[model samples]
Target: MKLLILGGTEFVGRAVVEAALGRGWEVTVFHRGRHAPPAGVRSLHGDRTTGPEGLAALATGSWDAVVDTWSGAPSAVRDAARLLADRVGRYAYVSSRSVYSWPPAAGLAEDGPLVEGSPDAGDVPYAESKMGGELAATAAFGAERTLHVRAGLIIGPYENIGRLPWWLGRVARGGTVLAPGPRSLPLQYVDARDLAEWTLDAVAAGLSGPYNLVSPPGHTTMGELLDACVRVTGADVELRWAEPEAVLAAGLEPWSELPVWLPPGEMYDAMHTADVSRAVAAGLRCRPVEETVADTWAWLESIGGVAPRRPDRPEVGLSPEREADFLAKYDPAGGDR
Candidate 1:
């Protein structure tokens, strides 16, 4: 199959590109030339936000499918979709779960109410921009020809967010580590390779409409995820689980400085626990948590554990001094000096 990918050099986009290539598909990547495409694929230089003139290079060839990872601007998505509407047989637009209304009620599906938007509401907010991109793609490609992937917390090797990698590197430190609790807190994430392979399958099957593209909610717990991290990192660390209230009271942030801990309250309790039965039934297979953790750590090793961590911002996870302080105060055993 011939595939065209927009923004294919980055995390999720790269996942699809590599997946398709591994399957021996002829792939062409259209990007701004900032990063080189993988060795085997063809690259076309263009900016999605630059309108028709920017996309001039893309007018020449046709493909069986197009996987778009562009969410910078809705106008860009609309323009790209319109420009290639006739050239591709199917269009797969990568939309995020954030497009759904924030703090969504528990058990909502893809058909659940989305963030309310005005036709005139500019994409000032990230959620609106993504939803606008979805609207733009569907507007150009039509519902029958477009596929919207509403992905939540996408984790795996190429993740730019540093969530999973933060945990992996922390575990590798091998000490009395601050593990978040209650230990069974559920996490929703899709492995990039898994999402990519499933995307190719959906495109091949000519499936359209929206799919909430993450592992089923409540399918994996906090213990499950952290255990996988420990097993993969092979760190000689002791995971000391602390209650969310204590963690927050101690000044650790959820989901940011502390990677995957979402405290129960109005913020994101429902967001991460969205129902994914539809996605699972649609063949969205997630590899075991251990496998994802192991592979991600392996990839991190290959790259010398470098990631997009900000130099100005101090490293995430607990600073040793802080963790020691917290343990002295919070850990019943008071292991800190």
Candidate 2:
């Protein structure tokens, strides 16, 4: 098999590249060259945001399949899909579950209504951008040849989004860590490597259309996840598990300040309870959360204990001052340790 990946130098894209290589497939990475792709694949340098001319390097080659992980503008996806429609045999767009309409109900599946988007749109919000990218891919490749990987909460090595890395780093600090409670609160996420492997298999099997790509709900709970982190990092921290009400009332934000945490409510239900039956039935197997956490810590240590941050995304996790203040004011387990 031969594969071409756009933006193949980091995060999910990098995972796809590595997974393809591990399968003994020939791989080509079309990227901006800001970071180096893995050693084995062919590299083509271009900036898709610069429009058509910047894509000159991509004009000459063809691949059995092309995986695009563009998240910024829909027009970029449109342009690339159009350019490669004839040359590439299959198109796989790494789309997000965020394309679902606002306040997606718990257990929403691939058939859920999507947000509005157009192939020609530019500089839109993340949800619309992904929706438009999906539209653009199918528009160019036809539904039979296009695969939409509607991924939710991707976390693993080479993660530039800073979710798991923040937890690992915070745990390494070894103090009273603000662990969100109702410890059994489940989470839905996919290890990028797992997502990559499944995508390659799906494309090879001629699978098309949107698949809600995530682990089954309750693959791991909040406590299990954090406990793994503490175990891996060998932190001597006390997990001050605070209730959702107390955490929110203390002016902390979910997802942003607290990273992977979402308070129990509509957002949590929407995010952590997606129906991934389609993906699971289609050969999606997630690694244990402990493995994910441990490997991520190992990777972080290799990279000097600091994870790279995407310029496009805002930084996550609570500041030391804010966390200290919150811990000082309210400890659900009683006064203070």
Candidate 3:
């Protein structure tokens, strides 16, 4: 199968490219030629934002599938879809759970309402722009030829961005760690490889429409998540509850401040849970969490301090007085701390 992937140089796109290549699929990547393509993959260079030159390059080429991970704006996706609708058998657009409206109640499914906005939402336009892009692709190719994979926080090896690695690195150092909220708060993440595998299966099976790519239903709390990090890295870190506002007041930026924290929200309050039964039933199997954690640690070690260790002193276990002080300053209402 010939697969053309847009923005396949890094993160999710790169993971998809790797998975496709492992399956022995002929993969071609379209980007600005900024980064080197993965080994054995051909690279095509052009700017999708400025003109039709990039689309024109693939105008005559036919592919079994096209996975779009880079088109942030709706117009960009619309342009691409118009060009590839007849050229490809299936078109997959990488979207986000951010498209869903805030306050994601438990047990929410893919049929939930979505947020609406333009392609550019200030600094990072990927989420909102992808929402618009999904609409355009669906319109261009129709449901039969299009599939939207709305992914949640993707965690796995080589995650240069601060998702799981940020907290893991912090805890590995053995100090008081600032947790957003309670230990049992909902936390969900999907390994990038798992996502890529499922996406490929979806294309191969000719699955269409929207599907939520998230972890299986289970309770993954803030504490458990941190504890797992500590266990893997052997970092001696203490847990400290800090309100969102207090975290800002202390001049400590939330994880969202980091460029890698794409989905902007408190990990505790921002519940991005979704039901992926449809995708799983269609042959999407996820790796165990332990494997993900081990792989992540291995990748971090391989990088060798690419992620700088925070200079702050290790936070010893919070004392009663400290806990009280933290609650008073951060969570006056005592709401789920």
Highest-scoring model, TM-score? 2
User: How many clashes show up per model?
Assistant: 0, 0, 6
Please give the TM-score that candidate 2 achieves against the real structure. Answer: 0.98
Estimate the lDDT of model 2. 0.93
Cα lDDT of model 3 by residue, 8-123, tens digit = 88768889999999999999998887677789898877788775665667677889999998545577887888888888889999887777776665566888877776532322
Range of the 10 consecutive residues with the lowest summed lDDT in candidate 3: 308-317
Question: Of models 2 and 3, which has the larger lDDT?
Answer: 2
- What lDDT tens digits, residue by residue, belong to model 2 across residues 170-210? 99999999898879989999999999999999989999999
- Using TM-score as the measure, name the better of candidate 1 and candidate 2: 2
**TM-scores for all predictions:** 0.92, 0.98, 0.79
Cα-based RMSD of the predictions, in order? 2.7, 1.3, 6.2
Better of 1 and 2 by lDDT: 2
**lDDT agreement with native, every candidate:** 0.82, 0.93, 0.71
Decide which is better by TM-score, 2 or 3: 2
Instruction: Decide which is better by TM-score, 1 or 3.
Output: 1
Q: Model 3 lDDT vs. the true structure?
A: 0.71
